[model samples]
Target chain A: MNVAPNNQIPNSQGLVKGMHEQEVEIAPGTLFDAEEMVINMGPQHPSTHGVLRVILKLDGETVRDLDCDIGYLHRGVEKIAEHDTYAMITPYWDRLDYVAAVSNDLCYVGGVEKLLGVEVPRRAEYLRVILTELQRIASHLLWLGTHAIDIGAVTVLLYAFREREEILKIFEDFIGARLTAHAFRIGGLWWDAYPEFDKRVRDFLKILPGRIDEYETLLNANRIWLSRTVGIGILPADEAINLSLTGPVLRGSGVNYDLRKAQPYSAYPEFDFEIPLGENGDTYDRYLVRMAEIRQSIRIIEQALDGLPEGPVMAKVPKVIKPPVGEVYFSIEAPKGEIGVYLVSDGTTKPYRMRIRPPAFINLQSLRRLSIGHLVADVVALIGTIDIVLGEVDR
Target chain B: MSDEEKVTPPDPSGDQPQQSETSGEKSPQSAKTEASADKPAPPRAAPSDKPSPPKAAPAKKPSITSEIAGDPFIDKIKETFGLAITEAVQTLGQQILRVNRDRYLELCGFLHDNETARFDMCTDLTASHWPERSGQEFEVVLLLYSTPNNRRIRIKAPLADGEACPSVSGIWAGANWMERETFDMFGIKFDGHPDLRRILLPEDWPGHPLRKEYPIEYRDNEWTDKHIEYREVDYDTSLIDVKYGERK
Candidate 1:
């Protein structure tokens, strides 16, 4: 047994800070000698988006085999949830996938609501739909920017961020927090939607539809963009479904299993929108799905705002939420994929156990399968297309 | 946007039968034809009017509202795995089965096969520790979803400390990472998992942190000193000097 080695510092092997540089013999790959190189890509690298470490075994430019070494960002979130009150647990879920914190809030709160059997206020349901859809669009905007940039389109990053900033501002106006917005309460919203929340959302809906067209124009015909992404990282539909993939990755592979449509939650059934799926489960198809989702999210926001209900957003439930002994699993169609909160409460104010089914963690498991035949450079694109938040993956 | 442009959630009136399988329902070459000029490809096509396969479970409109106890899906599970399931109940509008660890993999396969309950996606695999139940402290929880029927079921099995549970990663590939994470947190071993190493924690980290026995705050700094790299400079003396003006 290679028992727990006492020394903490992972052997600072080949350590020259700025970059991994090995001036070793570049064995000219003749028929005789084809040496494989095992290189570590991140736990520090910028393109990884966070501290994700993937150990790749490469034969020249082609990746021979790869092992993803995750967990650098693990903060014992589930352990922490066990100790905190049910109300406090919702806020921390915001940190799981910071980009779509509203979706996280809704999933956590939805479980609690189901366990309590509390009927949410009709107005709150609409508010939840609007805020979640807005957050979905916001999250996909970030994905579009990063995924585009990963494929070497730097200009799209600037354009995508320009719109995402407005969505964050709307969040800041509503909850006093932007990225990690803890805007949900157990029974309903902690506070009513800011009066101007409607206006700002409407404003975004007006301009974003046109802006989405702008993005399509920029990348739809660009030869470099199409060639780099079109056929890269082809994940077969069976392989994708077998991997328990969800959200865009699964949809891009032509599976129409969006939870919002398959299992309606909140006020989603009332609104009208479509689930955009792709023909091929490649990087470009995933990209197309997310882009269409932004449009669909906008459509949902518009419908929700148009048919805005007028009532209190908070449900009449006890302040100190101690539901009867029971467990409930509430899942929703989050921007990335299906996010669920499995809550087990033992008639206590604090949750006995809360399991977060992070889509990124489940979706990320398919990376090794997707990256098998692709080149080393395409790995970045594959990572981007999956749109994983390390915080969620490690949590 | 035209009238066709507006895509609503599937009608709850039972107009279109649900798709049966969880995934890989589409062939590899399957991609919807590109949108035509006359009518753009609606983001979500109307639910295929194709009828679903024969199901013993009635089409109880898949809504959070109208939650019926003794769902047919639960009945099918109880009927199939009677002895294995120690406890079966309907709680919080969803069905739950608490089974023994020995027959877990068997149950998973039965669920995956189409003849019985064909659960397509294993949404999650996690565990919770109950220190009060000293003998059976760890409880592994699996959340499974049936996409075609819009049904969710939870399977929980109890395991004593250091006892191994059969791995379901074979039946559901999504179970691979999930089982590893559960093993990492609760310290319950999986019988035949491919890579059962600690996933979220360093392999050398002491004790499972999610267990109730593990201290939230480690005052001893024993585990920290052993695992965290701070060899070059001792912060203890430097912090003391900075805090109280030169610790003479």
Candidate 2:
């Protein structure tokens, strides 16, 4: 095993080395030395999903060390949370996980609801389930698109985004805004579902399964797609558990844990759906799990629409939310994973402390472990398989 | 082992007496008699004739508080570890325990591995700044969860000016970035963290931006040299006199 020499080689002439010299004389009093190749992956790389920079210390193609640099998109959301009142902060939640705004809203509003002890109406709960499942589909669509693009598959991106656009159009119909839809309020929804909301949802339900079939037709059995994804970035169940990986990443590793099923919330128990599990625990498994999840989410949405009860959306919460002096931590099965909101209330409208348990942030930790010993090119595939949104990661 | 090495009778004031009284002691010989008794007997004295049965070893009892109390895993952890838990707040299967900074990691370690209070998942790490709070001005909160147990716990450690808490990154690899973010935002140091850097702020940025006292803006006149100095110019613009410029 011919390893390269640890130190710079001395030139035959032994002169103090210039820029191009084979060796350079050590500066006096230098006590320690090591050789490492530093590589900066991105503040703008495509696979990073946002302005995330990973500085890697590499031994040839293997990553020996990784330092993740974030905050490029830090809009000071926490500080903003402090400044804004409970009602006003909903918009900030929308931007945190822009792909799945409803889940973000649920995590935050759920905590606030617990703090205020307000019971949302059954209709509102069903509405929340419908919107959140729709948002989950939308989010997973974006993930499938970007993750495919991160790998060499381009057609999936186009097909996934096409379906995602339909979900956004539905969002636009429900709320005036689409991308950053602050549709949820503390007690319930910002407004009632539009008169055509049910019809539009049913319309999507009818169309989406075919669209999902379209996606599967394009990618699932394609030899190239299977070759790229199957058996790549395989995370063992124990390692996944130890790494604290969540969402589909954990499920792909054969963990039968979904917060919606394990600990039901917001009428999730009322709906009938299967908790999808994977066997191989690889990138292909993750893709299959998410694809199945999208289908399941559609089933949930259809159920929510058929059984959509009639009543007020907002519960009769306090005009001003002044929860008692206490703390409450609420978590929801967001599109990515477990999104948690830890709220400490001192009987004030503003929380004493608000902490967000971002799934992307935790999910990203397994990257280095999965990436090591693999080709540098595989880094993108591994990160894609993890399916992180840097907005949530940095937040 | 000599007779002196043989175990002696436990003192009446020892913890075994209290344990026996609470658990209702039953030796194999006494088990049948106790089972038939109408009412459970109080703590029974060791027989006077027989060598005092080696202080009945404390029963290997499962954690009853955790099973019965329905406390969050972390609360059960604090109780089991004997860590002083102060100002507990509980709601919706979530618990927050305020603990001194000194014992934060100890409590975290127990919670991460303990059978009953298995907070195997460290979900989030964050800090809150309170400049006006008297004894402790900075509060670091660790949010944890157990998928198996279906519970959440918040462990809060308060620090003064220079105190540091042991890092939980060893227990949960996910805490690496989170602990860095906490350090970046609140400047609360985790003493044994492998690499602690300002995660969400530039390395050269002045002061912790999230600190209450850190000025949000800089005023002019006493600017640092780095701010004052512009790029060195070859020639004064006013003195130049030529089609292109005066040669240096």
Candidate 3:
């Protein structure tokens, strides 16, 4: 919103002189116009969640023009990927979609695997499914926490984070890191899960359903929550499809498209779960869809744990993978939506070209259209409903 | 289990029949040598030679060209718009079409609103910087997906240095952000994009960071000793100006 002053700005003395002399003439055919007030919503605002700045042109409370300014947190990830070797780039992938770091890792590794023509072991595939599903739940927990707080539901944030901490503990047990887990290797996982991993995951599965119920109990039937969300930011199914919206945001709009179901990867095909859809695409529907997805993710993790295969964790590829001179595009269903890794390898340790298909970046597009007629207060609600992580958005 | 307890087990399903005909015992070093060879001979280490002869015919020949010739979409596109399909690369599920930049917008309009190729979604709009190519410095890649047909097409628009590509924002509103992002990354200006500005970088930032030639870091010449000198500023009056005024 920091508008550079025009080079043709009139001098203050000229402005005062003009005001003093303006009374002399009154023209019948003079044109009058009013400039729209531009307001900036932070490169550091709490509602932005990260370094996202939006410049808004407002007529009172209605948003006339909105410009989203990102890259305040840009670390030149693509440039870094070019410099680093294929094996060394997994950590960078973790940073792209920090919330669902495991999913990001999976997408990158999966793409690299396809390029190298490496087949991952059954155990590795199952482990990946378990970890990714857990990561999805954790990510949704954070979304539920922050999103509820953004909508003025203060207590729900605490409840959501409490459950998220347990998931983080499990992640720590497996990967030895909580937030930026560089757990996935090029062909498979960094190492096999610890002895307690299966048991700990099972314990989480046992308690997660009850914990989800507690979260629902706190907010689902609340009159204020319903009133604030229902019928707000309604995106029709056709419009949602046209806008290229995905994940819960698209499903909430009554589109029954899920990459996991449509194009199953890893052990997603083996898992028995339902793809929850909404009749109406609204802020409320999005919330419901995400909440339902959390339970479905738990079901997948439990099933994966029960039938966890015993085998090697990594594929028998060369230490340094050099894919043929070809381009491969692979997409995975991340917590937010479809996170794709488009890799163009020219038979080298380093990727010739690497492009990230970030779901948040795509979902962020609908904001301007969604916010057109809605009040300023509803803007926060709409953004929360979208559930974007700026790490992925700015990347 | 502890490291001592965890034994590295040998490969499982050792007795089971190999699902693929490709040799399983070949070392990684040999594969590298075969890859580096100028003419990569069709892999000959398979356990049996009878099943491979039929595969060699398709492998040695141009498969993609043949596939494109039979594709109904390519023929329909040619029939509808009279635009020749100059180049086609089919790898995995993605199809890349090299088209004329001059007729790019017209083709996009035909693709999006057209009933046959109802590419309702402009999933992604990105550009690749080819610094070595003087005539064609940037190749704008547009990923279009049709939900009705379950088909995807990637359109490539090669632009010369300092040239602008036609913006598809008018066709699909979703392209607004994607095009802006493409502009921010590759510096390929979109001719008719509304409010075209740097989306991922600061306005005053030097150069497009994604361009292959742009250096990652540069010396901060603006940081002078005089600018770093401490000054006695009123804290109480500065709070409002620093917080609310700057935000406004």
Q: Which candidate's lDDT is highest? A: 1
- Give the chain B TM-score for each candidate: 0.62, 0.57, 0.62
> How much lDDT does each candidate structure score?
0.78, 0.73, 0.76
State which candidate has the highest DockQ: 3
> What DockQ do you compute for every candidate structure?
0.23, 0.17, 0.23
Residue pairs with backbone overlap in model 2: none
Sort the candidates on TM-score, descending order.
1, 3, 2
Q: How far off is residue A334 in model 1, in Å?
A: 1.2
lDDT of 1 at B221: 51
Interface RMSD over true interface Cα atoms for each candidate: 10.9, 13.6, 10.5
lDDT: the better of candidates 1 and 3: 1
Write the number of the candidate with greater TM-score, choosing between 1 and 3: 1
**Could you give the interface RMSD of candidate 1 in angstroms?**
10.9
Candidate 3: pairs in clash: none
Tens digits of per-residue lDDT for model 3, A98-198: 87899999999999888777889989999999999999999999999888888889998998898899889989888998999878887788789999988
Q: Is the docking of candidate 1 incorrect, acceptable, medium or high quality?
A: incorrect
**In what order do the candidates fall by DockQ, top score first?**
3, 1, 2
Question: Residues B1-248, candidate 3, lDDT per residue (tens digit)?
Answer: 11111111112222123323223433444566555553334234332433434444434322222235567877777675565456766765567887878889989988987788888877778877777789888888888878777677888888898899998877776777788777877788998876576677655455676777664443332343235476454444333322211221
